[model samples]
Target: MEGFLEGIWHPLIDNEKCTNCGFCYNYCPKGVFEKNNQNIIVKNPADCVDGCHGCEWKCPGNAISFPKPITKEYVIKVIRWSKAKGRNVSKDFIKYALKNQIIQQDEVSKEMRD
Candidate 1:
């Protein structure tokens, strides 16, 4: 699950529209953005909390954007792929999907329900 999500859903900063106001750097609780001299970079993209859009909403320049939006279908696809690959999809990930409203409780597999 971590491997699949590592670079999948992180924010992308468009430099053209970015004013380097540091809103993303300051607002992100995951330390995803870091100040590099006068510029901001996504330093720890993998550390970003899944389904969070706080930084995007807080950015005054509207420079922050995610590659993909979290949705029930997307979550289900990931779970199915992980299972196909014989990966142990963690219950915490399922719980996170449910808590974030990305997927409903019934969408989780019967084996995953426990």
Candidate 2:
């Protein structure tokens, strides 16, 4: 649970496409999403918990998708956190983050608008 492992992966989101409705955030079982300035962000990307594809399946804008595979250690940490919190993470939620690439874009936009 400290290094990378094979078969581990996460979703990438497109912030431009996200409506910030919190659909992925609220639906995520592992608390993988967060809201900032009416946009969705990946607050707990390393805590995806489970590879469940619920978020990808539910996104209306198709703003979610899987990115480069992650390490098993990272995946374990994600799953461990979700279980400790009594929940399971969703793949769709991560997809929103991946498809939108929220992390870098959100920060850039936030700084510009400020």
Candidate 3:
């Protein structure tokens, strides 16, 4: 999951439901969220990374969204890396990823061949 992961993702706050709790601000390892005027804020959107959802889970107010989903090309790259590393991954794993919407079917074939 290193080197390259696709898609844009960041934590989004539900302001109304939010208790203005600073739990997310304190829990995030990347400091993506911060306490501003006693409210949680997305201080550094770019600092946020995909698949890192600690803040979302830690929020007592349940006021965060973990970015958009990843694309299929990204999944294929992961598959490729796993295969290249001789990991014991299933051949049908890619198909499962596509079916589950964990990855979209864009450029899957081309990337798989590489």
Candidate 4:
């Protein structure tokens, strides 16, 4: 999910495979994910570092995979471009991003609450 004019990337979680271990949330570098309830949810996917894939790697369930390959350089470049163009990002972009990636909102929010 992009934030403001910056094209920020977000994480998406697969509920079916997620073990609810919370490893991803605990290991996440940025405040990107927050766990909400039993089901993992995607709250602030934009803060996720592009191509970090830390959560996905740590997931024993193999429940995580990006819809598209994400890279830190790509995110930085897209954000820089968007800022230069002065384009305001929309919520749809975020929703769309959540469609991809291996994280969820409820888990993200739950982790935040902890």
Candidate 2, residue 34: how far the Cα is off, in Å = 0.4
Q: Model 3: per-residue lDDT, tens digit, 3-100? A: 33434667899888799867777777788877777777898877776545567666787777755644565566566776687764344656556676
What would the per-residue lDDT of candidate 2 be over residues 1-114, giving only the tens digit for each residue? 224332354567987787777889889887888887788888777776445567877888888876754444444455455556666444554444446554344543343243
Q: Report lDDT (Cα) of residue 111, candidate 3.
A: 59
TM-score of each: 0.57, 0.51, 0.56, 0.50
Error of 4 at 42 (Å): 2.1
lDDT of 4 by residue, 1-114 (tens): 234334444567888888888777777778666777765566776677653556776678888776566443344444455556675433343333446543355643343343
In model 1, how many backbone clashes occur?
A: 0
| Over 4 Å off, model 3 | 1-7, 69-114
Q: Taking the candidates one at a time, how many backbone clashes does each contain?
A: 0, 23, 1, 26
Per-residue C-alpha lDDT of model 1 across residues 1-114, encoded as one tens digit per residue: 445556577899999999998888888878999999999999998888765567876788888888987677777776777678787766666766788787777768653543
Instruction: State which candidate has the highest lDDT.
Output: 1
**Model 2 Cα shift for residue 112 (angstroms):** 52
| C-alpha lDDT of all candidate models, in order | 0.77, 0.62, 0.67, 0.58
Prediction 2 TM-score vs. true: 0.51
Clashing residue pairs in candidate 3 (N, C-alpha, C atoms within 3 angstroms): 72-104
Tell me how candidate 2 scores on lDDT. 0.62
RMSD of 4: 14.3
Off by over 4 Å in 2: 1-8, 69-114
